[model samples]
Target chain A: MADEAGAAKERKILVAVDESEESMYALTWCLKNVSVSSNSKDTLILLYVMPPRTVYTALDGTGYLFSSDIMATMQKYSNDVADCVIEKSKRMCREQVQDVKVETIIEHGDPRDAICQVAEKLHVDMLVMGSHGYGLIKRAFLGSVSNHCAQNVKCPVLIVKRPKASSGSS
Target chain B: MADEAGAAKERKILVAVDESEESMYALTWCLKNVSVSSNSKDTLILLYVMPPRTVYTALDGTGYLFSSDIMATMQKYSNDVADCVIEKSKRMCREQVQDVKVETIIEHGDPRDAICQVAEKLHVDMLVMGSHGYGLIKRAFLGSVSNHCAQNVKCPVLIVKRPKASSGSS
Candidate 1:
């Protein structure tokens, strides 16, 4: 077919995942709805971005309430969350598309910037993410990460918003 | 093998096209980067939205600048542009993906609202569009059509941004 020549090149699709159900829904949606070519070498890279750890100073805004061990425990919990999210997302891909090549990536920073940076560094063909679906007031106070990456990422960005009716089912 | 069951249902992808080079580039990018499945019956709907015809009323904002003949001429020009854009886009799909089914839709209204409404009405699986890549000032001054659709559309929205480096090559 005419498209065979175009399918020779490998295409990488980066999907940003975290603890949110929205992100997982995005991964499922992509598996069901977006893949460049079945004959082509297509890879689904599951990306998990961890928020940067906050330092505890003597006069920190939180009153330096946490001791050294407490801070370490918090860091451990964050790592656990990231691991769980990645494992779940990988399992989903395996269940949905058996032959799809899958890879995992973990980054640290603000999600908005880290997502864009990793997508550029990896030179992905497209970036898939889920919108938190925040309302007007909540979105205003806590800016939407998907929106930020959509504006900044150099590659194509796919923002998947779970339908309101299906939100409860998921 | 596992995906065959999922591929039985038909998937519709809506790609919004216009006169802008960015939009054309987006169509090309989508053809190369995003398609649900090769075996599944997927339809690509090339939608060209005409900005709603302006009302030329006496004592209007333009100080009653247009006569009846002028208004009719302007309307004809708008229709011509829509036809030309759709033809160009159809040719592109034929060149790239010959076997894939393609459809065309011409809508009249503000693109932001019209795009969202059309995607919902068609029950498309995904909505593909090109990012105008407006700067902060320009985007603020004239709200982005892609951004609005991404926020409002029920289906996954793919906003393809033509890379700055390759913008000139195309």
Candidate 2:
């Protein structure tokens, strides 16, 4: 066995990441505000969900109609965005909590479903996310991803909102 | 000056309160999970927002058509619900954190607007609320109160989710 006697008691926290300033602020807030005492190891799971390319994953769409070039472009675009977000989150966390162990998850499909599914599958103790995001065209001002995950996930959710007037926070 | 030199540094956290188990669990969760070290005094503000009696407040409608008795009854009902919820939250927190200070505010309006307004007016450091509440049929399982506050409020919101299988947590 490893030298760590209390590895079994580690707390797993799932943090959602995206390119939005709010999302990066949430990552920084979690590192600053969340408890990571030395007595028990806690893992911060950074998750970036990419929307599935509709031409490829849509149930009724004809995959052959669009040609492979279009599909490849969309796929590559999502991959690049995912990579960018995860790396940025890593950089942010390093500036805040250098000793904390971090893990990254990049997945495809609906952001809401993907976050909830991963949190449940991993049995995380808590889910942290930005209060609002920039996606969804005609929905409420509140971002749907944070709202849906907060409701469905069986863990406490910390929705970090960047204070409207506070530049000193982040 | 008062004997306490650091009273100005106390953090004011406002927790939205209601009769739902989710809200009560949120209050309990705040006491157990949030920082409450002896060195820093954190005050918890218990807020209960009473939905406005639409018949009395609607601008275009014949608000005057309704008898004063009808308006009074609706007002009384909201008052009763607000009172009951505030009392219940006080009782809940007493059993958890005896030293924590609790304050209750009841206002009549849309729950979404009222919660955000009070949080700003009071200048709370953090807004704690239950993730899912009993409201809105079309929203993805998350309630509108927690969702809207998380989006509009300037303070960080902690949306407590009662873990589905954890009965012993409280």
Candidate 3:
């Protein structure tokens, strides 16, 4: 019982990663800033949510159907991207902190919903993610993922914005 | 110097508190989850932004000239609320964490801009705040402070949302 109680207190921080440098910056920032506890009990979970593949039918307005070969190629590209991102994040964590435990999770769905559901199911202590910092017009069209997650997640959500001035340099 | 470098590495977490229970809940959550480092060098700053008081004059629409005494009384009321909230937050922090360094600051301005400015000025490692979780109708009327800060603040911003299911019990 005591052990369970102790285990429950261990922090599980989930960082939502994508191909963007913004998300990578957020991951690096979280490692340096939040994962440095002396006890090192905090576990960093790198989560990559693959956007659902859109299926096209003959009835669609475009009147074109994607062949299985093309679909397979697209899926392969996505898988490669996810693998590349997770590997880079893992290496960054290794370089930034010692004895910091990192776990990677790849999920498929709309990222906004998937991230929130994973955080809830895992009972993560905090969720760290990056802001796309979309302009008013862009946000109106694309909607902000970090904003959506911040509103929906059960745990606290940290949105890290890559500073405009430092964007070129980074 | 080595000391300066060590101090620079120390995390400065800024929590924006108002009279709202949501803000208090964020403070409590941050204390338990974020400020548990064994080394205890992380400094927790409790910042309270008092909304700018509107000055009334005869030229203003629907203006009834307020006497000096009335203005003084209103000022006193605002001050009292700030003091009360700060006191409660201090007590909660004391009860929750051991040897955690805390400092308090009071500023007067629009909370959205004031919080961003303060967080930038302090070079805070992260900003911890509570989301009002306003619905579309309410949010359209009153812009979200957490959302604004999350977008504008240079450092990371953690917006804690009070779960609706637990609102009544809390």
Candidate 4:
């Protein structure tokens, strides 16, 4: 088990994917870049966070009714989203990398927070992600996940840009 | 004229924009984050490369024959792209800055090389950009722009990540 962990101990790269073309570029880039040496496993962890939804539960006897089904359904949706991200990530990895272990994670909450949490938990050597465009007002008001991650995370972060038609690549 | 040049003194910022959403985010972030005092004029030089089109151009004489036109169009497009960027940047700077001028530059070359050259030519105080994700292969094979910029550029480089959603404005 120790040897397994050590052999699998490649640089932990946490890539946050939003399923955009930019995210896909990041994913593809990682598969091509990270080494799969025996001692340096270079594990790739793909993460996706679902935007949170607020549902009114109950208001005493005044005006609302609580529904367990709603919560259950939300959990199910979370799982489904995770599954989708994992499936897509795995497919991309298979095409680009061989004999490399890949892990997929899906979480429910703010994307930036979830990403930071995972990075800390996994002790990732570096974090890789695609930038999602958020304007100044929106970013100042709502905040940008990438900015937050860059500021807070202990590890170095790699943010990839989407390819342009003139960029000459798919 | 000297005063205008002095007033319009060039402040170099290594602006990296791909067709990616994150690159846009980085541009937006720079517009908001970079400070332009009354004494200093600022130039946000936008840099982009057409990737490796040499192969495709080699195959199709059409692509090669029209290379000059393509370059000219790219220059025009760069101007247009820079116009949009400066417009947005000006909007962000409206309240925060006064008497600060903006200049846009478009170059067709390797993104990293173009950035470094501009930084050197203008003797920039700092290099600011958004990160692009690169895993091992692409990083090893092509090299990451951020990493290369950090290693090659003499000035300090700032790499901004997107803000996290959960964290309130900072």
Among these predictions, the greatest DockQ belongs to: 1
- lDDT tens digits, residue span B35-86, model 1: 5336447789999888566543432457467766787777889899999999
Q: Which candidate is the best by lDDT?
A: 1
Off by over 4 Å in 4: A1-9, A34-40, A53-78, A133-141, A166-170, B1-170
**C-alpha local distance difference test of each model:** 0.77, 0.72, 0.76, 0.58
On residues A24-142, what C-alpha lDDT tens digit does candidate 3 reach at each position? Answer: 87887777666764647888999998756653223233646566676677789989999999999999888778888899999987777888999999988789998973234544665
Scoring the B chain of model 3 against the true B chain gives a TM-score of 0.83
Model 3 lDDT tens row, B80-130: 988998888888888778788889999886778788998999988789998
Candidate scoring better on TM-score of 1 and 4: 1
Share of reference contacts found in each model = 0.55, 0.47, 0.50, 0.02
Error of 3 at B99 (Å): 3.4
Model 3, residue A102: C-alpha shift (Å): 3.0
TM-score of chain B of each: 0.82, 0.76, 0.83, 0.59
**Rank by lDDT, descending?**
1, 3, 2, 4
Q: How close is candidate 3 at the interface, in terms of C-alpha RMSD after superposing the true interface residues? A: 6.3
- Report the C-alpha lDDT of model 4 over B64-162, residue by residue, as the tens digit: 455666766755665575567555545544544455455555565566787888878876644666566222344466666776675566544556444
Docking class of 1: acceptable
For residues B1-170, what per-residue lDDT tens digits would candidate 2 score against the true structure? 11111123477889988767777777777765564443136788898876666736673267556567777787788688788999988887676666777778877666678889999999887788886664445234334777678778887788877655545642
Each model's DockQ score: 0.45, 0.24, 0.39, 0.03
User: Model 1, B90: alpha-carbon shift in Å?
Assistant: 1.4
Sort by DockQ, best first: 1, 3, 2, 4
